[model samples]
Target: MASSDSTASVPDLPSKPPAWANGSPSVRRPAFQWAPYLFLLPTVGLLFLFSLYPMLYGVWMSLRTTDVIHGTSTFVGLNNYLQLFHDPQFGLSVLNTAWYTLTVVPLIVAGSIAIAVFLRDSRPARLLARVGFYVPFVLSPVVVATSWKWLLNEDLGVINGFLKWAGLATIPWLSSDFSARVSVVVATAWNLVGFYMLMVLAGLSQISAEFYEAARIEGATGWHRFWHITLPMLRPTILLVVILATIHATQAFETILLLTDGGPGGATRLVVQNMYQSAFGRLQPGYGVAQAVVLLPVILFVAWLQMRLFKQEGVI
Candidate 1:
């Protein structure tokens, strides 16, 4: 009777449901919500002012012939593009760029993969080796090209000196057409391999150790493991590297400019270099812009083709 009286003395409290549960609005939003957009205004404004404006201007310029002397532009339709088809030099530049892409892309992929695999371990020596390989990537392209130019000099280069020391005949690395092309290819690959190695390493890091453990349990050898597991898992990364390398090779200009300057009968002349010469050296802005416009489609097509192939293989 005493416990019942104590319980009855407690006051009864009223229960209320939350606003959201009662189907009423829970959050009271501020009347002024333009803060986020205000923060993004500067970036959006700069992109439109610089990138979009220049691209639109370039397209307009491509359709018109500009007189540099009088600062006047005359609309010429697609005549600039039409003339590019019959220009032998333009054709040669395209072929050279194609060759550079075909050669350098494979070399970079193979070399970077090999290096990344070898240095995948976390040993001190491996870490040092990784740093050594990546150092060249951080250097300026101009500095790298200049250094290679000195090293590949025909008469007094370090490589020729070594060859002479070994009693072998010296080769003209930058003088002959074949050697000049080879030299340029080698220098390009050397400059780029380290950066791609980092990409491969990043891909490797994403692979699960369980896959390797399962392979080992199945008695798979190192070669079998790499072939069946590593390569398959790295397909997306390899595709990315391939596309980037192709674009780099196609637009190659600065290194070739400083190293060979498209010398030895124009063996190393690339499309970008050709465009640059036309625009600046020859003062044909319309023709140069046309070349750039044409190149855009070609690069997009090649990249699209790669993605398509990778999709068919179930890689991407």
Candidate 2:
């Protein structure tokens, strides 16, 4: 009885496994507490290398003046930045890009929303219409630029031929500075409007149709329904479309490079063209980088303001 009681009273001691049988101790973080952070390492590294480093390096380069061949760089403070203000060409580029953004942003946003609203629930339309609209987005920019260039030719182009046949004189589509700039805006809209429309269509489709049906029962006119129901529902998507259009407008390079080359004497040139000229034309790589550096802050601030609008619209 005594031996049994003593055995019952003793707690079971845990035994350690043989060291060789189990394996060596591994220094491992707890999965629940630390595994997520471990998984995030690669993402952090990518952002740092691809996004952060280039931007920061551009800023550093922008603040310095360096010869292309010598590879020696010296800090020039704000001289390069001041040079941009003094440069007439830079001013023109900024104005042209601003005008481009002004033209495209409103037209694309409004046109896309209108088209999407009309098409999202479109029925009994030919399948060809959908394909035709979406096709431009898939086409390579080079192809679009080349095709437009051919069509807009002053002498032998189809557009000019049609105008002549219609008893109208040929307009200089790509000749005069004013006309050329307007042409780019129209071309950009032609190429991009479909893409924006599709995005708006997706957003509109997410909204329930029952809302409109209910509004119908309450004597809402077509315009009333659109203004009160459609516009409010599409606020998020409209905001997104505008933001994206702004970024695209600001970064517009390929079409401009191929089509105008920022020409008719820099009248239609943009900041990116200026950067290219700085880096490659003048071989002042650092100055180009500086312009980019100065531009980024402005972009970020605009993006932030747009995002705040998103927040107000309950998107973010």
lDDT of each: 0.83, 0.79
lDDT of 2: 0.79
TM-score of 2: 0.82
Task: Give the per-residue Cα lDDT of candidate 2 at 65.
Answer: 90
Find the candidate with the highest lDDT and give its number. 1
- Per residue, candidate 1 scores C-alpha lDDT tens digits across 191-227 of 8888888788778877889999999999999999999
Off by over 4 Å in 1: 1-33, 300-316
Q: Write the per-residue lDDT of candidate 2 for residues 153-269, one digit (tens) a residue.
A: 989899999999999989998878998988888878888888887777667766778999999999999899999999998887788898888887775578877888888888778
Clashing pairs in 1: none
lDDT score of residue 192 within candidate 2: 86
In model 1, what is the error at residue 192, expressed in angstroms?
Answer: 1.4
Each prediction's number of clashing residue pairs: 0, 0
Candidate 1's C-alpha lDDT?
A: 0.83
TM-score of 1: 0.82
